[model samples]
Target: MTYVDGFVLPVPEGKIDAYRQMAESAGKIWMEHGALQYKECVLEDAKPEMPEDAPETCKITPFGKLAGTKDGETVIFAFIVYKSREHRDEVNKKVMADPRMQEACDENNMPFDPSRMAYGGFKALVDL
Candidate 1:
Protein backbone atom coordinates (compact mmCIF):
# COMPACT_ATOMS: atom_id res chain seq x y z
CA MET A 1 0.00 0.00 0.00
CA THR A 2 1.09 3.54 -0.69
CA TYR A 3 0.12 7.01 0.35
CA VAL A 4 0.42 9.63 -2.33
CA ASP A 5 0.31 13.35 -2.78
CA GLY A 6 -1.27 14.54 -6.01
CA PHE A 7 -1.34 17.86 -7.79
CA VAL A 8 -2.94 19.44 -10.83
CA LEU A 9 -2.19 22.91 -12.10
CA PRO A 10 -2.22 25.10 -15.16
CA VAL A 11 0.96 26.36 -16.77
CA PRO A 12 1.35 28.57 -19.77
CA GLU A 13 2.54 26.70 -22.87
CA GLY A 14 5.46 29.07 -23.24
CA LYS A 15 6.50 28.35 -19.66
CA ILE A 16 6.51 24.56 -19.96
CA ASP A 17 10.30 24.37 -20.05
CA ALA A 18 10.59 26.50 -16.93
CA TYR A 19 7.95 24.41 -15.19
CA ARG A 20 9.74 21.22 -16.17
CA GLN A 21 12.98 22.49 -14.75
CA MET A 22 11.30 23.41 -11.49
CA ALA A 23 9.53 20.07 -11.26
CA GLU A 24 12.74 18.18 -11.97
CA SER A 25 14.51 20.01 -9.18
CA ALA A 26 11.64 19.46 -6.78
CA GLY A 27 11.32 15.79 -7.72
CA LYS A 28 14.95 15.19 -6.90
CA ILE A 29 14.46 16.75 -3.50
CA TRP A 30 11.42 14.59 -2.83
CA MET A 31 13.36 11.46 -3.78
CA GLU A 32 16.28 12.47 -1.62
CA HIS A 33 13.87 12.87 1.26
CA GLY A 34 12.76 9.23 0.87
CA ALA A 35 9.75 9.47 -1.40
CA LEU A 36 9.32 6.16 -3.23
CA GLN A 37 8.49 7.85 -6.51
CA TYR A 38 7.93 11.28 -8.01
CA LYS A 39 6.26 11.98 -11.33
CA GLU A 40 4.99 14.95 -13.30
CA CYS A 41 2.96 14.68 -16.49
CA VAL A 42 1.64 17.29 -18.86
CA LEU A 43 -1.61 16.77 -20.70
CA GLU A 44 -1.29 15.74 -24.34
CA ASP A 45 -4.66 14.46 -25.55
CA ALA A 46 -7.21 15.36 -22.91
CA LYS A 47 -10.47 15.20 -24.79
CA PRO A 48 -13.40 13.94 -22.72
CA GLU A 49 -15.24 10.87 -23.96
CA MET A 50 -18.39 10.28 -21.95
CA PRO A 51 -20.28 7.00 -21.80
CA GLU A 52 -23.75 7.21 -23.41
CA ASP A 53 -25.40 5.60 -20.41
CA ALA A 54 -23.88 8.00 -17.91
CA PRO A 55 -25.88 10.83 -16.37
CA GLU A 56 -25.47 14.35 -17.72
CA THR A 57 -23.73 15.41 -14.55
CA CYS A 58 -21.34 12.52 -14.97
CA LYS A 59 -19.91 13.81 -18.20
CA ILE A 60 -16.16 13.60 -18.12
CA THR A 61 -14.41 16.94 -18.00
CA PRO A 62 -10.95 17.21 -19.46
CA PHE A 63 -8.09 18.38 -17.31
CA GLY A 64 -7.85 21.64 -19.21
CA LYS A 65 -11.49 22.41 -18.56
CA LEU A 66 -11.29 21.32 -14.96
CA ALA A 67 -8.35 23.63 -14.38
CA GLY A 68 -9.87 26.48 -16.36
CA THR A 69 -6.83 26.38 -18.56
CA LYS A 70 -6.44 29.28 -20.95
CA ASP A 71 -5.84 28.96 -24.69
CA GLY A 72 -2.09 29.20 -24.24
CA GLU A 73 -1.97 27.03 -21.14
CA THR A 74 -1.95 23.33 -20.33
CA VAL A 75 -2.49 21.19 -17.26
CA ILE A 76 0.16 19.37 -15.28
CA PHE A 77 -0.61 16.33 -13.15
CA ALA A 78 1.95 15.34 -10.55
CA PHE A 79 2.29 12.88 -7.69
CA ILE A 80 4.67 11.61 -5.09
CA VAL A 81 4.30 8.16 -3.60
CA TYR A 82 5.35 6.83 -0.21
CA LYS A 83 5.23 3.50 1.55
CA SER A 84 2.46 4.70 3.87
CA ARG A 85 0.88 7.80 5.36
CA GLU A 86 3.44 7.96 8.14
CA HIS A 87 6.28 7.63 5.67
CA ARG A 88 4.75 10.33 3.51
CA ASP A 89 4.51 12.64 6.53
CA GLU A 90 8.08 11.99 7.54
CA VAL A 91 9.45 12.52 4.04
CA ASN A 92 7.38 15.65 3.44
CA LYS A 93 8.48 17.14 6.73
CA LYS A 94 12.10 16.74 5.71
CA VAL A 95 11.46 17.94 2.18
CA MET A 96 9.74 21.07 3.50
CA ALA A 97 12.61 21.76 5.90
CA ASP A 98 15.30 21.38 3.26
CA PRO A 99 17.02 24.52 2.07
CA ARG A 100 16.57 23.48 -1.54
CA MET A 101 12.83 23.30 -1.06
CA GLN A 102 12.83 26.79 0.43
CA GLU A 103 14.83 28.01 -2.52
CA ALA A 104 12.32 26.50 -4.91
CA CYS A 105 9.45 28.26 -3.13
CA ASP A 106 11.02 31.71 -3.15
CA GLU A 107 8.46 34.03 -4.71
CA ASN A 108 10.88 35.46 -7.21
CA ASN A 109 11.99 32.01 -8.42
CA MET A 110 8.74 30.08 -8.72
CA PRO A 111 7.71 29.19 -12.27
CA PHE A 112 3.95 28.98 -11.61
CA ASP A 113 1.32 30.60 -9.40
CA PRO A 114 1.12 28.77 -6.09
CA SER A 115 -2.44 29.90 -5.52
CA ARG A 116 -3.67 28.13 -8.66
CA MET A 117 -2.18 24.75 -7.81
CA ALA A 118 -4.57 22.01 -6.61
CA TYR A 119 -3.01 19.53 -4.21
CA GLY A 120 -4.25 16.65 -2.04
CA GLY A 121 -3.16 13.51 -0.23
CA PHE A 122 -4.59 10.14 -1.29
CA LYS A 123 -4.56 6.57 -0.07
CA ALA A 124 -4.03 4.08 -2.87
CA LEU A 125 -7.18 1.97 -3.38
CA VAL A 126 -5.70 -0.36 -5.98
CA ASP A 127 -2.14 -0.64 -7.16
CA LEU A 128 -1.27 -3.37 -9.56
Candidate 2:
Protein backbone atom coordinates (compact mmCIF):
# COMPACT_ATOMS: atom_id res chain seq x y z
CA MET A 1 0.00 0.00 0.00
CA THR A 2 1.11 3.57 -0.55
CA TYR A 3 1.91 5.70 2.48
CA VAL A 4 1.44 9.41 2.77
CA ASP A 5 2.36 12.16 5.15
CA GLY A 6 -0.19 14.94 5.23
CA PHE A 7 0.16 18.33 6.80
CA VAL A 8 -1.72 21.58 7.29
CA LEU A 9 -0.44 24.78 8.80
CA PRO A 10 -1.10 28.51 8.97
CA VAL A 11 1.23 30.51 6.80
CA PRO A 12 2.00 34.04 7.89
CA GLU A 13 1.08 36.77 5.43
CA GLY A 14 4.54 38.24 5.24
CA LYS A 15 6.60 35.22 4.24
CA ILE A 16 4.60 33.36 1.63
CA ASP A 17 7.13 33.67 -1.14
CA ALA A 18 10.08 32.54 0.91
CA TYR A 19 8.08 29.69 2.33
CA ARG A 20 6.96 28.59 -1.12
CA GLN A 21 10.50 28.60 -2.38
CA MET A 22 11.67 26.58 0.59
CA ALA A 23 8.82 24.17 0.19
CA GLU A 24 9.60 23.74 -3.47
CA SER A 25 13.16 22.86 -2.67
CA ALA A 26 12.12 20.45 0.03
CA GLY A 27 9.58 18.86 -2.27
CA LYS A 28 12.27 18.25 -4.83
CA ILE A 29 14.40 16.57 -2.22
CA TRP A 30 11.55 14.36 -1.18
CA MET A 31 10.94 13.33 -4.77
CA GLU A 32 14.58 12.64 -5.33
CA HIS A 33 14.58 10.55 -2.19
CA GLY A 34 11.80 8.35 -3.67
CA ALA A 35 8.56 10.06 -2.88
CA LEU A 36 5.94 9.16 -5.45
CA GLN A 37 4.44 12.61 -5.25
CA TYR A 38 4.64 15.88 -3.33
CA LYS A 39 1.93 18.47 -3.35
CA GLU A 40 1.23 21.79 -1.66
CA CYS A 41 -1.84 23.95 -1.86
CA VAL A 42 -2.97 27.21 -0.29
CA LEU A 43 -6.40 27.44 1.30
CA GLU A 44 -8.57 29.84 -0.63
CA ASP A 45 -12.28 29.31 -0.13
CA ALA A 46 -12.45 27.67 3.24
CA LYS A 47 -15.42 28.30 5.52
CA PRO A 48 -15.49 27.59 9.21
CA GLU A 49 -15.77 23.85 9.55
CA MET A 50 -15.61 21.43 12.43
CA PRO A 51 -12.06 20.63 11.27
CA GLU A 52 -12.28 17.21 9.71
CA ASP A 53 -9.60 14.70 8.72
CA ALA A 54 -8.48 17.24 6.12
CA PRO A 55 -9.74 20.28 4.27
CA GLU A 56 -11.92 19.38 1.29
CA THR A 57 -9.91 21.35 -1.24
CA CYS A 58 -8.16 24.64 -2.03
CA LYS A 59 -9.10 27.24 -4.59
CA ILE A 60 -7.27 30.27 -5.87
CA THR A 61 -7.77 33.45 -3.86
CA PRO A 62 -6.52 37.00 -4.05
CA PHE A 63 -3.35 37.49 -2.06
CA GLY A 64 -4.89 40.21 0.05
CA LYS A 65 -8.00 38.14 0.74
CA LEU A 66 -5.92 35.14 1.72
CA ALA A 67 -3.91 37.29 4.04
CA GLY A 68 -7.03 38.76 5.59
CA THR A 69 -8.91 35.51 6.13
CA LYS A 70 -10.60 35.35 9.52
CA ASP A 71 -7.99 35.71 12.28
CA GLY A 72 -5.50 36.51 9.51
CA GLU A 73 -5.19 32.86 8.64
CA THR A 74 -3.96 31.27 5.43
CA VAL A 75 -3.64 27.52 5.36
CA ILE A 76 -0.87 25.66 3.58
CA PHE A 77 -1.49 22.00 3.09
CA ALA A 78 0.87 19.36 1.73
CA PHE A 79 1.30 15.66 1.31
CA ILE A 80 4.13 13.36 0.33
CA VAL A 81 3.40 9.91 -0.95
CA TYR A 82 5.65 6.86 -0.98
CA LYS A 83 5.46 3.27 -2.09
CA SER A 84 5.00 1.96 1.44
CA ARG A 85 5.38 2.87 5.07
CA GLU A 86 8.92 1.50 5.29
CA HIS A 87 10.00 3.36 2.18
CA ARG A 88 8.33 6.49 3.47
CA ASP A 89 10.21 6.22 6.73
CA GLU A 90 13.51 5.57 4.98
CA VAL A 91 13.22 8.51 2.64
CA ASN A 92 11.93 10.71 5.45
CA LYS A 93 14.92 9.87 7.58
CA LYS A 94 17.27 10.82 4.76
CA VAL A 95 15.28 13.97 4.12
CA MET A 96 15.58 14.94 7.77
CA ALA A 97 19.33 14.37 7.83
CA ASP A 98 20.01 16.34 4.71
CA PRO A 99 21.55 19.77 5.34
CA ARG A 100 18.85 21.35 3.24
CA MET A 101 16.35 20.22 5.84
CA GLN A 102 17.81 22.74 8.27
CA GLU A 103 17.34 25.53 5.79
CA ALA A 104 13.82 24.33 5.12
CA CYS A 105 13.07 24.35 8.81
CA ASP A 106 14.08 27.99 9.23
CA GLU A 107 10.99 29.20 11.11
CA ASN A 108 12.16 32.78 10.98
CA ASN A 109 11.57 32.75 7.26
CA MET A 110 8.90 30.04 7.13
CA PRO A 111 5.46 31.40 6.45
CA PHE A 112 3.78 28.55 8.34
CA ASP A 113 3.46 28.48 12.12
CA PRO A 114 5.25 25.27 13.05
CA SER A 115 3.74 25.20 16.51
CA ARG A 116 0.20 25.05 15.17
CA MET A 117 0.75 22.66 12.29
CA ALA A 118 -1.47 19.58 11.94
CA TYR A 119 0.04 16.48 10.42
CA GLY A 120 -0.26 12.73 10.22
CA GLY A 121 0.93 9.68 8.34
CA PHE A 122 -1.61 7.61 6.47
CA LYS A 123 -1.64 4.33 4.61
CA ALA A 124 -3.57 4.41 1.41
CA LEU A 125 -6.29 1.81 1.27
CA VAL A 126 -7.39 2.70 -2.23
CA ASP A 127 -6.27 4.99 -5.01
CA LEU A 128 -8.06 5.55 -8.25
Candidate 3:
Protein backbone atom coordinates (compact mmCIF):
# COMPACT_ATOMS: atom_id res chain seq x y z
CA MET A 1 0.00 0.00 0.00
CA THR A 2 1.16 3.51 -0.70
CA TYR A 3 1.76 6.09 1.99
CA VAL A 4 0.60 9.62 1.42
CA ASP A 5 1.22 13.07 2.75
CA GLY A 6 -1.65 15.52 2.44
CA PHE A 7 -1.74 19.27 2.78
CA VAL A 8 -4.41 21.93 2.83
CA LEU A 9 -3.62 25.60 2.98
CA PRO A 10 -4.90 29.02 2.06
CA VAL A 11 -3.18 31.08 -0.60
CA PRO A 12 -3.80 34.65 -1.53
CA GLU A 13 -5.65 35.08 -4.80
CA GLY A 14 -3.00 37.33 -6.27
CA LYS A 15 -0.30 34.82 -5.41
CA ILE A 16 -1.79 31.82 -7.18
CA ASP A 17 0.70 32.04 -10.01
CA ALA A 18 3.60 32.29 -7.61
CA TYR A 19 2.24 29.42 -5.58
CA ARG A 20 1.90 27.29 -8.69
CA GLN A 21 5.47 28.01 -9.66
CA MET A 22 6.71 27.08 -6.22
CA ALA A 23 4.61 23.93 -6.16
CA GLU A 24 5.93 22.89 -9.52
CA SER A 25 9.52 23.17 -8.37
CA ALA A 26 8.81 21.40 -5.12
CA GLY A 27 6.85 18.66 -6.86
CA LYS A 28 9.73 18.01 -9.18
CA ILE A 29 12.07 17.65 -6.22
CA TRP A 30 9.72 15.22 -4.51
CA MET A 31 9.35 13.17 -7.66
CA GLU A 32 13.09 13.06 -8.12
CA HIS A 33 13.43 11.94 -4.50
CA GLY A 34 11.11 8.95 -5.17
CA ALA A 35 7.58 10.21 -4.75
CA LEU A 36 5.28 8.25 -7.03
CA GLN A 37 2.85 11.09 -7.48
CA TYR A 38 2.56 14.76 -6.56
CA LYS A 39 -0.49 16.90 -7.08
CA GLU A 40 -1.64 20.37 -6.14
CA CYS A 41 -5.17 21.53 -6.63
CA VAL A 42 -6.81 24.91 -6.15
CA LEU A 43 -10.34 25.30 -4.95
CA GLU A 44 -12.83 25.88 -7.74
CA ASP A 45 -16.18 26.09 -5.99
CA ALA A 46 -16.41 25.28 -2.30
CA LYS A 47 -19.21 26.42 -0.08
CA PRO A 48 -20.07 26.18 3.57
CA GLU A 49 -22.81 23.81 4.59
CA MET A 50 -26.06 24.84 6.23
CA PRO A 51 -26.49 24.17 9.94
CA GLU A 52 -29.09 21.56 9.35
CA ASP A 53 -27.03 19.77 6.74
CA ALA A 54 -23.92 19.54 8.90
CA PRO A 55 -22.76 16.06 9.87
CA GLU A 56 -23.23 15.06 13.47
CA THR A 57 -20.07 13.02 13.79
CA CYS A 58 -18.02 16.14 13.32
CA LYS A 59 -18.23 19.58 11.84
CA ILE A 60 -18.88 19.40 8.11
CA THR A 61 -16.32 22.01 7.32
CA PRO A 62 -15.52 22.45 3.67
CA PHE A 63 -11.98 22.92 2.40
CA GLY A 64 -12.53 26.70 2.24
CA LYS A 65 -13.74 26.78 5.82
CA LEU A 66 -11.05 24.40 7.01
CA ALA A 67 -8.42 26.70 5.51
CA GLY A 68 -10.12 29.74 7.08
CA THR A 69 -9.89 31.45 3.73
CA LYS A 70 -10.51 35.18 3.60
CA ASP A 71 -12.25 37.28 0.96
CA GLY A 72 -9.34 37.20 -1.46
CA GLU A 73 -7.88 33.88 -0.40
CA THR A 74 -8.39 30.40 -1.83
CA VAL A 75 -7.63 26.90 -0.62
CA ILE A 76 -5.04 24.53 -2.01
CA PHE A 77 -5.04 20.77 -1.57
CA ALA A 78 -1.84 18.87 -2.25
CA PHE A 79 -0.53 15.38 -1.83
CA ILE A 80 2.54 13.23 -2.34
CA VAL A 81 2.50 9.48 -2.60
CA TYR A 82 5.24 7.03 -1.75
CA LYS A 83 5.62 3.28 -1.86
CA SER A 84 5.47 3.02 1.92
CA ARG A 85 6.01 4.92 5.14
CA GLU A 86 9.69 4.09 5.20
CA HIS A 87 10.06 5.13 1.58
CA ARG A 88 8.30 8.38 2.35
CA ASP A 89 10.65 9.10 5.22
CA GLU A 90 13.66 8.33 3.08
CA VAL A 91 12.44 10.47 0.22
CA ASN A 92 11.59 13.37 2.53
CA LYS A 93 15.04 13.28 4.12
CA LYS A 94 16.66 13.53 0.71
CA VAL A 95 14.21 16.18 -0.50
CA MET A 96 14.87 18.33 2.54
CA ALA A 97 18.62 17.99 2.13
CA ASP A 98 18.63 18.97 -1.53
CA PRO A 99 20.30 22.32 -2.21
CA ARG A 100 17.57 23.34 -4.60
CA MET A 101 14.94 22.87 -1.91
CA GLN A 102 16.86 25.06 0.47
CA GLU A 103 17.47 27.66 -2.21
CA ALA A 104 13.81 27.79 -3.10
CA CYS A 105 12.75 28.24 0.51
CA ASP A 106 15.41 30.83 1.20
CA GLU A 107 15.06 32.88 -2.00
CA ASN A 108 11.32 32.82 -2.52
CA ASN A 109 8.65 34.30 -0.31
CA MET A 110 6.00 31.61 0.14
CA PRO A 111 2.58 32.61 -1.16
CA PHE A 112 0.73 31.14 1.79
CA ASP A 113 0.93 31.21 5.56
CA PRO A 114 3.03 28.28 6.71
CA SER A 115 1.53 28.42 10.17
CA ARG A 116 -1.98 27.99 8.80
CA MET A 117 -1.15 24.98 6.67
CA ALA A 118 -2.64 21.63 7.64
CA TYR A 119 -0.65 18.48 6.99
CA GLY A 120 -0.81 14.79 7.78
CA GLY A 121 0.47 11.41 6.75
CA PHE A 122 -1.95 8.65 5.88
CA LYS A 123 -1.77 4.92 5.29
CA ALA A 124 -3.99 3.86 2.45
CA LEU A 125 -6.91 1.77 3.60
CA VAL A 126 -8.37 1.03 0.22
CA ASP A 127 -7.34 1.56 -3.36
CA LEU A 128 -9.22 0.64 -6.48
Candidate topping lDDT? 1
Best by TM-score: 1
For model 2, what is the error of residue 9's alpha carbon versus the real structure, in angstroms, after optimal superposition?
Answer: 0.6
Q: What tens digits encode model 3's per-residue C-alpha lDDT throughout 1-128?
A: 99999999999999999999999999999999999999999998687556785678756668887789999999999999999999999999999999989887774577888888999999999966
The Cα RMSD of model 2 versus the native structure comes to: 6.9
lDDT, candidate 2, equals 0.78
Compared with the true structure, all predictions reach lDDT values of 0.92, 0.78, 0.91
lDDT-sorted candidate list, best first: 1, 3, 2
| Model 3 worst lDDT window (10 residues) | 47-56
Worst 10 residues of 1 by lDDT: 107-116
| Candidate order, TM-score descending | 1, 3, 2
Better of 1 and 2 by TM-score: 1
Per-model TM values vs. the true structure = 0.91, 0.77, 0.88
- Winner on lDDT between 1 and 2 is 1
lDDT of 1 at 60: 72
Residue 67 of model 2 has an lDDT of 38
Give one digit per residue, the lDDT tens place, for model 2 in 1-128: 78999987777657678778888999999988889999988776565444466566743455334334446567787899998999999999999988888777877756666777778999998977
